[model samples]
Target chain A: MSTPTETETPSETETEGGTRLSYETRDRLYHLALYGSAALFSAVILFPIYWMVQNAFTDSQTVITEFSWLPSPETVTLDNFSVLAAGAVPRYVINTIVVTAGTIVVVVGVSLVAGYGMARFRFRYKESFAQFLLLGYMFSPIVLGLPLYLIWSEIGLLNAQIGLVIALSSISMPFAVWLMWKYIQTIPESMEESAWIAGASRWRTFWDVVVPQTKPAIVACALFAFAIAWNDFTFAQILLPSQESTTFAPGIMRLIDQGGYTSWGDIMAVSLLMTVPPLLFAYFLQEYLLKGFEVRTR
Target chain B: MTVHIDNMTRVFDSPNADRIVAVDELSLTIEDGEFLTLVGPSGCGKTTTLRCVAGLDTPTAGTIRVDDRDVTELPPQQRDVALLFQDIALYPHMSVRKNMEYGLKIAGVPEDERREHVAEAAALLQIGDQLDKMPASLSGGQQQRVALGRSLVRDPSVFLFDEPMSDLDAKLKRELRPVVQRITDEIGCPVLYVTHDQEEAMTMSDRIAIMDDGELQQAGSPKEVYSEPINDFVGEFIGQPAMEFFDAHVESANGTAAVSMGDHTVSLPATADELEGYVDSPVRVGVRPQQIGIGDPAEGIEAEHVLDEPLGDETHSIFETEFGDVTVVTHADFDGDGDTEYGLVLDESATQLFDPDSGVRIH
Candidate 1:
């Protein structure tokens, strides 16, 4: 049976003004455009991810020799994942996790204190200082990497995970502070004053009142610092030349650049594994991230 | 404990403009269990004074003493005072119970004691069932109760409310005013409440302190301030519908003073020696709307009927006369029709005379 057309159905809810398009038809057209663009953009962005997943499940020989839209069920194997377990991939991942966690801790600590001060305190050149913070954020990591490398070498922190953590934190610190400062501004001063009048010292009030209200901003800052430290390659490669200190991003590059036949299957498998932490973070904390950027007054 | 504010002053230094004096050498005292309301127009420094008492804002020049102990140099947390903000300032992330428990916890009260105090406060505020609910989940009145509960649990030496009921609806304000008064009575502390609403001041305060231009105009019981305002500003400000002023010529005969506005004249007692200086000169006469009698043209000064506004139980009749618009409050049943002439009768006992230039009361 055929569905009814616009001409045949003749919508009773047609709007009175401007145009003859029925409300339902207009709504449907708007949603179609919206969801169509979303789906197309998602596909464009996700195609490489789809390919990586396909390569990750296939045997190394099959991934190097064959190109297929869909893998044959019989040829699909868990051997590529087994190759990862038998190699240094897990160690590199652990290193990446360590750097990301350290970056988060440092970034969150500095940003909370600095941001709260910026939001609440009054002092000379405070506005100028806040603007200067974003200036550091504007510089590319490549521009900072060499100077940071020189600094780390001079400080005897080179070829170490601690060096990478400090470097990553510096890169993300400005943006995290700016985010937190603006977010904290939305919280009313009365809340803090109320706490103070309730017999809480300034420090106690900051921890009890300001910190809890800043959960969304804290989560967003952590995710941002995580992404910087986890996906970072230029700083990691330049700072940590030793094999033992290398993280996932540079370690994956080393696996591909062995000067022989490249392991496409192994690269895709490790790359797929490398994407998991950030994916999981974004999946769970997307609500707070949205709230962090929301224009709210509370 | 009694709270004494001695010459409290606050000057705000602005970068781009002239320095502003927010509160100028204001002094007042609140005896224990007394609810004193600082009422004034906007920018009259009531909120600034309250903040100074709470130690949130330091007075540029003053001493604030609670129970004869000077607290002017103390930090807000060190000063034993509880302030309820106009926004109600409840911690949004905390549950009602935790909010009430916050101050107690900060004071290092035992957890069991904190729980007991919170329960007692919640019971007093009628919010026992709301202990587990977040502030956002509660109604406006309930949220106000939670805020009050938070303060109640602290049991501070002084309670400060900065227009706490201003955020509530009219009905809620009427409902909460008595509850707040009762709470303050139960706490038996010196409460400093700040508001610009004169009705709230009159209905809620044991003594209403009226302020203008960062200076105290008058401080008295509502009835005294209403009937015996010390100046034209206080006379005009303290009453609802406000006292109206008219320029009148004074005439003294047989040691008694008679003042005439338009064609109406009212005789005053000989005891008002201040009126002798203004003989045949213009004096400002301020009279409340309820005190001005309205009747037929034969009774007194003739005025053209302008409008009659019904205010629930009373009608405010506006009349255009030789001395500007005069409003008279009468029974709700009295409604003036268009184009009718009415006479305004002013009794000397009900009218206040002031110097036209200084606005200081002449009698």
Candidate 2:
């Protein structure tokens, strides 16, 4: 079906004195080029992941040699994964997992309620208070390093998993609260009113009526907060004083060392391992993440 | 189910404070199964009156009773009255059944009975097909029906409508007004409906109360309120294009009096014996547009057509005359010009006379 009422190139020319090509052919060619270019561009964007995996599978020498312009069979091997098992990569991976999981749970749980209250409740200087909370995100971690280190040391929290969890959650809280605030505001006021009129108290209304509607944004917010906390290098650098307690970024930094020879294969394997959890988290939360960003423009 | 208000006037602020007197010393009775409507212009006390009856507001001064029981001191739930606001406050997140079941659930009705009431209401509103659908999924008219259903499930002794159909479109208003009328009639539950639109009041009420300036101007059947307005305000507020009033004089001769208005004269022959002593009394006399007609051009009381407002069915001609601006609807155009001299005859028997200074009906 076509919107024939519109003036196409050839039709405008044939009917109203123009010098363009026939409109039907031009319209067909336009849509065809549109779809073809879209697919080509999306494939180009995904090509790096495919190259990374293919190179990961190759034997060490062959993989390096055949890391060419395209995918090849002879240069693939599992040596990269084997080399990383002998290093501290596995323990580093476990440390990253604990930190990311702990940060996500605490952040999402605390932030949803705080955000809901901030957005829905009217209080004295509530807006200013919210802006003040977000001010935590304004300072560079490098600048806060000395202060954070001293604070942690005074409390004997330095180089600890609990300290990492606290640090990550505090950093990610402002973003979570802001995202949830915007999303929860969209749920209709009538829902809560009805719940109230139905004899449910305000808390019951939040949990039963308002909370269910905000799941998509909450899921997306958790993933985003987790990704940010998991990939953070500065807090890890400042807090970890020992390799035994180091997370992925600091662990990897310690591994490379002040040596001439760098463990290229093991580093690649650890980098690949460090990227997996976020990729999986994002994959499961793909729908909400897409919707979360979609609503930004709309 | 009795409501009583004593000195129940609601002043939002203090005695000397700036405020709008929504219900100004308004008092009335809603006998068991009697449907009463508080009709008025905006800012009149109609809505306030309904809210007072619903126990939504405490009246500053007055008493309300349902079956002679004093309910003025009660809360909404204790008042046993269901209020339907003009905004149709339905729960958008709930299904039609859930919406209907909501109030019942709040009142602690058992699950089975709640389902029974919801089902019955759903059937009554013909929204059974939409029982599982959320309110956002329904059309505007359907939402109104669901709101009605929600109130219906409450099964209160009285129903108070606060301009309920005012938010609806013309067609839907036309469609739902009669349904509401029929339900209120069938239920025989004393209903106090409030609306600012006179037409909605006329079509829906067995009795219409015209209000202005925080007071009830007149309360009676539609015909009585229109034909026998108690004052100039009621006279001017009731009819389409309103009742025309102008300064006129009464003079006596041969024991009979004639009311003179410019070049026009109407007899008070019907009230000759009744109005024997009154002469040269200045009064404001009213005539309806429907009453005055295209009389014989040479014989009738004379008027000049100043302008003609062509409503689809009939053309109304406004005349700037010796008396005042008089308007009449004429089916046939007497002249093509915008302003032309024309003649009119007042139906003297139907014409009403009021004392101009006090605006009270005189004889």
Candidate 3:
């Protein structure tokens, strides 16, 4: 809502000295550059999702024959969404929900406590242990999946939904704990000490004071764990081979393999559906998630 | 209600450095209803001593007793002491009322009783209307009142304030000082307040315990410490403009004693008997700014005027003398732009002598 001011006349200001700019002019130019890059980056990132939505609503014949920026309304139909009502797609979604919920519960609870201890307490090898957590997080999931498959097969945990849940949690938990630890560090320690002096035991103080202050971090950690478990393909593919335990990420591929044919419309529809929960999570909880990442000092 | 800190010591050790003795072997006692301000410079261990009494920091060697019971090893909750932090540590998520009720709730006080305690404390602190508001919704002073109300509800046997008003502005500090004093007086508990401001110690405390370098320098009433300081550190630390000192030599001959500085000398009074030991030896002569006066140019010790600081009711005039710079406080106005030379009249009877080597009072 800014009107054009004297600084908006770049030529007049630049005439004084070609390299020297007025403060307002310089600030406007910087913002224009920043927003230009952001728009370009967002377009690049969002194009695939936009194309998937476009193709999902179009008939498979038209989608295959035409390359268009916008879908024609005449070809749009609800027939592509029939995958949601039938086949392994529904079962895959149910399995994903159970695994995602379990991962969230395990990750949020454990990381909350571990993060509190890491931020507040001092013990032997504390720094080393913290570094070790980051080190564990750096390994690719494929590196863990192969070794973990051998162990799961030995224990008969293979092809179980619980095995997938456990695998996903281990993959996501280290970074979640690191996020929580850094977030909790921003909270003042005196807030906890005040509770301790108020006759609350250490556990009671942690619950009454620290937990309430960490709500944003809790939400953010839950979302993080959910995204990891929901979108995970490697661990789910390796551990849960049965269709009953297979989640959407790898289960949708089974359709192409079933009859030596690819239903591009059905595939696009399923891919769009797969992106919903995470998109909803990002849209609804973006405030708390942003706050969780902000390292505000008090 | 009395708190006894006996030979308490706290030592911190780390791998990269030598051990830090935060609080040396120090002993002190706070009688019931006494408002004792632990006043000192930074890194002087005043806060450490207060923390030990509150059971926040464990003393490495000595025992602390509260109300005739040894509470040295007890945690802060079991010690029955309420501490007001300088940071005003209020629970940000809770309303003022909930903040006050937290201690009682943890102690298993029933809902009705907890509400009553919270209500009473809220009314007492004039924060009754703010009970339902979050701490962030209130002003800084109001937030601090909520913090005070939180401690007031507990009614602990000992009250500890760690520079509570240090964050407030000058006007706010002056307003809150009497409020804190009146509340502590009504509670009749041993209150140990810590601050580095000497003026705060003088105005608010019934007695002051001055500390330096992890050791107790002196502990007495403000009047007593200001007038009869045991050492040069206390003399220099207690006053606003600070007491000035000059190098002088004691000259004792035939039952009379006098101290000479540069070319001027002042005869000692009946207390000259103490100067016999310091005869023909160097000493530090300490005098308050108020004790010296601007004299005639040819009468007293010759000096050159440096600057004049007008402090409302009085002016502090700094002058360069043969020994060093001396400050003379007077009620008369002096122009800083004029008058570069003057003589300083030393008040003979008011001057105190100290050993130059140890900075300890000689008489």
Best by lDDT: 1
Chain B TM, per prediction: 0.96, 0.89, 0.94
**Angstrom error at residue B72, model 3:** 1.1
Q: Which of 2 and 3 is ahead in TM-score?
A: 3
Please, what are the lDDT tens digits per residue for candidate 3 over residues B170-281?
A: 8888878887887788678999999999999999889999999899989999999999998999999998789989888887734556788878887766355666678899
List model 3 lDDT by residue over A1-298, tens digit each: 2446543566766787787777686778999999999999999999999999999999988887888898888999988999887888899989999999999999999999999999988899998898887786777888999999999999989988888888888777788888889888978877877788888888999899988888888898898898899999999989988988898888887876778768888989998998988989988898765664452322
lDDT of 2 by residue, B104-150 (tens): 87678999999998888778778888999877678889988888888
Docking class of 2: incorrect
Candidate 1 lDDT by residue in tens digits, A1-298: 1235633233444334544666457667889999999999999999999999999988889888888999889778877886567667877888888888999999999999999999999989998987887788677878998888898899999998989998889889989999999989988999999999888888989999999889889998998998889899999998987788889889988999978889888888888888886899888899766775452343
Better of 1 and 3 by TM-score: 1
Q: Give the C-alpha miss distance for residue B98 in model 3, angstroms.
A: 1.3
Model 3: residue A190 alpha-carbon error in angstroms: 2.0
Give me the runs in candidate 1 sitting further than 4 Å from their true place.
A1-39, A288-298, B270-272
Q: Candidate 2 at residue B66, lDDT?
A: 75
lDDT of 2 by residue, A29-49 (tens): 898999999989988987766
How many steric clashes does model 2 contain? Answer: 28
* TM-scores of chain A, one for each prediction: 0.86, 0.78, 0.85
- CAPRI tier of model 3: medium
